[model samples]
Target: MRDLEAGLVDAATGHAIVATDADGVVVVFSRGAEILLGYPCDEVLGSHVARLFDEAELGSVLAAGDLDTDAPARREWTLRGRDGVPVPAEVVVTRRPGVGGVPAGHLFVATDLTERRQAEQLQDELIGKLGHDLRSPLTSVLGYAQLLDDDTLTDEQRGYVNAIERNGRRLLHLINELQTGTGRSRSAWRGRRIRRR
Candidate 1:
């Protein structure tokens, strides 16, 4: 039984697990918490768990009732590392129960969000670059196609120009949707609409 208990404790230590009493005094700090926060377990074990967060954000979290709920609640928090720098963290808080069905404490599980945020930002930048590079050349193609809609063209030539104009409009619509996330592209431009310009 002791070995099984120790194994469970070891598993918890792999995550940034923290347990605090009802009044918010820290009761347990895990090894993963120490590594992530850069704080020694001794420095935080008996202190208030508030040391992990900025006062203003902590107040907001308290007001949001994220710390105590019948079920686990997850929210983003900027926790203070031992170096005094803010760490972007996503924390899940749940109630810890004691023997005899009494309320024991709160348990917190935290994960760093820095890498995920960075990846999302990078994706946005790449999308912007693709939109710019692609649309510039497409604009020139569209401008020249519009110039070809003159009456001097033969019937076969006019048919070719109509095809070009229709395809170009569809491409532009697709590009617009890509950047703006609007729904599906509208139907291809009508012949009269193309001839008007």
Candidate 2:
């Protein structure tokens, strides 16, 4: 059983898995946790898990109060590292049972969100650029189509001009939708960042 547990811990690449007694004392600190937070198991195993985060940051986790054994809770927060660096992380906590099937400890699995946030920012930037490039030509096309209505033209020419105006408006609408979607995504990102502060 010990060997199986050890293997599980070893396999937790890029994921921080920690176990703490019901009293909040750390008992299992996996290698992935060390890599993520820069603390070795020997140093953290006997310490309280709260020591890894700021006093204020615990609000999201503690708000749930005492959890029933087997019940899992999740939250996102900025975790402070041994080096005093803050890492944006999402943690899932599950209550573990002891010999008598009573709640004895808690297990935590945390994933770092730094890379994911960076990727989102990059995607937003790219989308913004694409929207800008598309709108410029669309604006010109719409303007020209609108001006054509003021000129004298044959019936067939009027029909062609109307088609141009209609398609131009449609293209402009599509671009606006793209920009609106990107703006909403950026707003959500900002909201999450503000909550973490």
Candidate 3:
């Protein structure tokens, strides 16, 4: 069983795995942990597992409750790299059961969240740019529609102009909602004019 666990840990390349004794002393540091944390196994093996975690975060977790529970605990944490940079990670800590169901040790597995966070930030920026691009043209359309509501037109012409104005205002309101993440009334835009640039 120990050999099987070691084999699995060695094969894992994408997640950092650190196994510690019940007293929190590091015992097994996987290759993935070395790459993720910038620390070789020899330097980390005899140290306390807390050295790999951000101090404040570790303090908070310790204050919250014991980590040797039967159920695995998962949370987002900031790990301290050997170079002293903070590495965002999703961590899962599972207790290793011993004789009579007591905890012998704990296994800490962490997955890096840096790339996922960067991708999300890029997505938000693109959405904001798209909203700005859409709004500029929409403002012009609404302004032109408002200008066409003059008194020199037949009933049919007036009806067509009114339809254009109404639909344009609705579309603009929808765009504003998308950008701001809140519903706003079209009356908020009443009497607003676009300046030529």
Candidate 4:
């Protein structure tokens, strides 16, 4: 049974697992924890788990009585690494039961959020760039359409110009919303009617 538990913890390379005794003394530090925290098991074992957290963060958790419950508690935490770097993570902590159903220790499983945050930021940048690139040419098209609305044109030609300007304004409005991350409804645009000059 011990061997199976060890194997499971060792195999989880994507999630850091740290087990502590009821008093918060480090008992098990998985390989994933070592890689994420830059701490060797030799140095971390028998040490207080509080050392891995910022003082204020640890204090908040303790004050919140998160450890007093049997149900797993999850929260976002910024753990201090061996090199003093901060690692943002989503952490789930559960109480480990011992003999006679008494709480023997706690198990912490943490998933690193650094890569996810970076990817989201990059996506926002790309979207902003695409919106800017599209708006420039669209502005030119709208300007030419406006200039074409002169009295020299036939009635049908003027109607075509009106359609172009209306659709162009709608498209521009959508692009502006996208750039601002407002995510306004598309149905709102459908009901709007742009007046012709």
Against the reference, the lDDT scores of all candidates come to 0.80, 0.80, 0.85, 0.89
Candidate 1 per-residue C-alpha lDDT over 1-197 given as tens digits, one digit per residue, 9 for 90 to 100: 96785467557754688889978899878778888899998999889999998889999878987666668888888889999988888998898887886768898889888787788677667666887888989888888989998999999998888888888787777668756757732223112242332
- Candidate 2 to truth, TM: 0.79
Candidate 2 Cα errors over 4 Å, as ranges: 66-69, 154-156, 182-197
lDDT of 4 by residue, 1-197 (tens): 99999999989989999999989999999999999999999999999999888789989999989988999999999999999999999999999998999899999999999998798788678768988898999999999999999999999999999989988888888778867767765335445665644
**In candidate 3, what are the lDDT values of residues 1-197, reduced to their tens digit?**
99998989978979999999889999999989999999998999989998999999999888988584678999999999999999999999999887898788899999999898788677667657877988888789878878888889888998887877777777667667656657644335445664322
Name the TM-score of candidate 1. Answer: 0.77
TM-score of each: 0.77, 0.79, 0.78, 0.78
| Candidate 3, residue 19: lDDT | 92
List pairs with backbone clashes in candidate 3.
Answer: none
Go through the candidates in order and give the clash count of each: 0, 0, 0, 0
Give the Å error, residue 63, model 4. Answer: 2.8
| Poorest lDDT segment (10 consecutive residues) of candidate 2 | 188-197
